[model samples]
Target chain A: MGTITVEKANELFWLGRYAERVYTTLREFFIGFDRMIEAEEAYIEYCKIVDVPNVYESKREFLEKYPFDTENPDSILSNLYRAYDNALVLRDEIHTETLSYIQLSIYDMKKARVSIAPLIEMQKVIDNLLAFWGSVDDKVDEEKTRSIIKLGRRVERIDLYLRFRMSCDKLKTEKNKLEKRIVRTGLKYDESKLCELSSMIDSGEILLNQAIALIESLVEV
Target chain B: MEQLYKQSEVVNDLLARYGVKFGIYKNGNFKEQLFPFDAIPRVITKEEFNYLERGLSQRVRALNCFLKDIYAEKKIVKDGVLPEEFLYASSGYLAECESIMPPKGIYSHISGIDLVQSKDGTWYVLEDNLRVPSGASYPMIARELCRRSSPGTFMENKVCDNRNYASLLKQVMDYSNTGGINVIMTPGRYNAAYFEHSYLAEKTGSVLVCGSDLFVEGDHLYYRDYTGKKIQVGAVYRRISDEYLDPMTFKEESVIGVPNIMKVYKKGNVALINAPGNGIADDKGIYYFVPKMIQYYLGEESVLNNASTYLPFYQKDMEYVLENFDKLVIKDVAEAGGYGVVFGSSFTKEKKEDFIELLKREPRRFIAQEVIDFIDIDIMEGDQQVPRKADLRAFVLTGEDTYVWKSGLTRFSRNPDSFIVNSSQGGGFKDTWVLSQ
Candidate 1:
């Protein structure tokens, strides 16, 4: 129940979004990387399913640019940078020990960038991101702060799950978690939109775009 | 000590892992760089530290008295101990702060005094930084990691634990609280010392906030939380400068400053640590009279030495400065961070003449001092230990009384030829150990 300003709330919310973005995207990138070995143009299907622009000209270009290119807004490195941008400002709330894992993730990403065996290096990046979330859960003592971050995490996972056309059961589980966590955050949110999104998931045939829009605009921070 | 030095890389890697860095701006782009750590500490014996503790306390006390006098009675100026021109001409002097009594009448709650030791073992005060002094956290955190890196070095040595800085700081803020919560207001995360600001806030248990997070209402300042709940803030360890602290009172164009917060401060509703208008006491031109200030206010001789400084505004000092122009170092009064400092000997004949002409034209803008060839400390370079120039910034916290921390920040030049040890100028830092024995 510690006091957090509107600005800090915004940072915490986006910190959740960006950290989740980097985590879910990195996990997706690994799967895509495996597919690219057998099928060189497998990333095009990833771009289509994930709703990102296919900017890579070839399999070689996709492998080099997908996770490492900072210029590409959809790249994993860009998402990690965004996560760092939000976490850097929230050091007082997140605590340094919690934030250092994010710092380590960036360093791991930089190592992956110049790294000869990048996929091997990227495995550490994923490990650091996982450690970051574990630290966030263990170190952040305040209930409201923890709840907001979890809400953002749950919202993002659902968005990505919807984009990947995940199972109705998987989407419902994330939706149930978000519904339970949102009430604990003390943040202003569109409660009606949450209910509507929940009903759409329960219907078992979700309109993916409308559900993504609902989750993005759910929080008023 | 050898054990600690052997593990320097491990300690540095831990520092980098913990995000121990400072931000710097170059070509309009901001980048954060690790503040390089030198494992070799500058050790001060108990007796030496006792002497420094007394001297630093006296100097800070006199400076505080001068700030009170400058804003109120002008007794130091009236008594002829300090010149009036130096008081008014100082860019730090604020006309708006006249007769505004801060909470508990404490002007400088925290003072960072820069000091250097000459080859002859004589210590001289280089500068007094009263406004938003940083680098305390650098040493504090380094000490923590150093002990973790080599606990035996601390066990074998009698080095005092320097981790009480946060408690000391909390005491200052709590002592000055006007009946509400404490907060550390920063410009944002892009500031050069943002790491220190956030770290201190975490350590001291104060909320770290930017300008937009706070507001003034009915002569009181309040912090608005995310849920729109208003919490009154009693003490603010503000890291922003005076001009950017209150947009209504200072620069009208500053978006990073709270509007009319000064009105709340003036009303004695909240305390601003190292209260506004302290720049007047720490001005370089006013530094010439610090010895006289100690004599006038405390009726005691200054235990610390001011590095044989001469102001060209005085007829006698001007003649001596002109005669010994090439042997002295000239510093611009308005600039800091090692920017406006120059060695007279480094100037060419034509450039020296032009500089002398400029100095003569604007005598009040600069102060000339005899260069103190300070002693060099050993820092590990590659494999061999080499001597490098270093300076110590001793932090003094004034609350119910003046208390100087036993440990300080010891910064050294990474380049062997340079004397500028500012972090912004590519300098590295070491922990200062005051031996308990």
Candidate 2:
């Protein structure tokens, strides 16, 4: 089992990505939906943040089609589904109850209805998902695997902050977790290069080359 | 507030946390779904359970005798209680298990007897599952969760503590084991009863194994550990059917079966819990003859009652089945888990005629049962309580001794009108309480 078939390794990688995708996206969407409630033509600002078209005929359509829709692979519901599916096959590798919590949370999320109830109640779902992800970080036997998942979580956090134009303070916390996760995963990078990229993003002027350099530095390892 | 009787949201909450669940396949993807929990315990008084225990054990004891007779002496056939052709033609009859007596000479070490109580409180045995049956773990765990959710509920009532299921299971496996480790072999995480398999393994302290974890080398079955270490396996409570057991012996291409394990088994290096060829004992066709086997072999009258079964193999029984085709429940001898069962009353006239024609052509394939007016159990439908059809799967363990776990899994259909109580059919399960009194 430790031979780690390439397919299972890929599943592990995707499981990390998908779990983070659902988690970060839901948090981002909730914030935008709140802001759009008071802004002029709420869809424009929200769409700008999420990097999607505000093209729905109305705000109602956008709300209906977003968050929990499975038909949309980009939706929170679909991503969680994929995460759980991946975790299902990896039960022998991870803690059983850890996988169970992921499945339980996703199952509960799938039943969310189209009401204002989702807006207020979505936080509990987020907390459960975060708890599920946290349990994996805490309970996984291989600290390297936890580091890898945190890598995925950090990357997704970066994606959310860059895409949603969130305050840097929020991104800062995620970045710190990601940095701590990196220590355990054993990824190498030049300190000077990371400083340069952070400053560029802070100045709202992300250099694709510098970012690519940082990402490639880890991969080439 | 008092917990509502019947199926309720309250009970479902308890079931989910304890991992009371079943597996299903949708769009070719395997998923484990929580079987809905009905809050109402299918309450059986101490006296009633005693009667059931007597009958079920009697029925199983007879089945064991018949299994031995069919595999060895064929005395039942010679004695004219059973026909040779009937035993030979049976799909459950396995030539591989010929003349092989399991450890302790026990076959059907664990029996899952399905029963339905009628309005009059009389219970009728619907079928016998001598092969691996699930749901025992569901109610066992559910009871723990429920008692914690409401301590007073059990205090005010007399209910049997079914938590000893794991101990009973352990004893059965240990008694039947040749000498090594007790392993619960599961197909994988996707099999419909994976939860039960894993849960039982944890509770019984048996190692949970997949097909890949086992291999036969030099006529011995061995379990491969994570670090490439191999340990001899003394006993295996295989959850998979006998057909997929040793691919080399049965289905050669089965990726889920261990190769050459039969060689080890035949050499008596390890013991298979419930043993192979159990289909012969649990087969629906063989069910009709249990009472006869009891009388012929055990020298005792049947303690439990069947559902008035009419096997089509006999010309006289076939005629009777044809005449009552619209009133009887026809079951395919090979089907289990409520599959291949058809209620005559539910069929169209043309369908009934078609079934009759099929029965006439292959009389050995079916047995028609007179439908009893079985009582309905209540389940929660949102906030309202509704009556739904349900059945109990009671686990009786035969070790160096015979014992029954007090708790049994009670499965009920989610649909109010459906008689099917299979988890694969979207049914939910409840914890059964056999009162300690």
Once fitted onto the true fold, the runs of candidate 2 whose alpha carbons sit more than 4 angstroms away are A1-75, A89-97, A111-119, A133-221, B4-7, B14-21, B25-34, B178-181, B205-207, B223-227, B322-326, B343-352, B379-388, B413-418
- Fnat for candidate 1 (0 to 1): 0.75
Q: Candidate 2's residue-wise lDDT over B312-418, tens digit each?
A: 88888988987777888889987877789998888887887787788888888888999888899876666766788888888888888667667688988887678
Model 1 RMSD in Å is: 1.1
- Candidate 1 stretches with Cα past 4 Å from truth are none
Chain A (candidate 2) TM-score to true chain A: 0.77
DockQ of 1: 0.73
Chain A TM-scores, one per candidate?
0.96, 0.77
DockQ-based CAPRI category assigned to the predicted complex of candidate 2: incorrect
Query: Which RMSD does model 2 reach against the true structure?
Result: 5.5
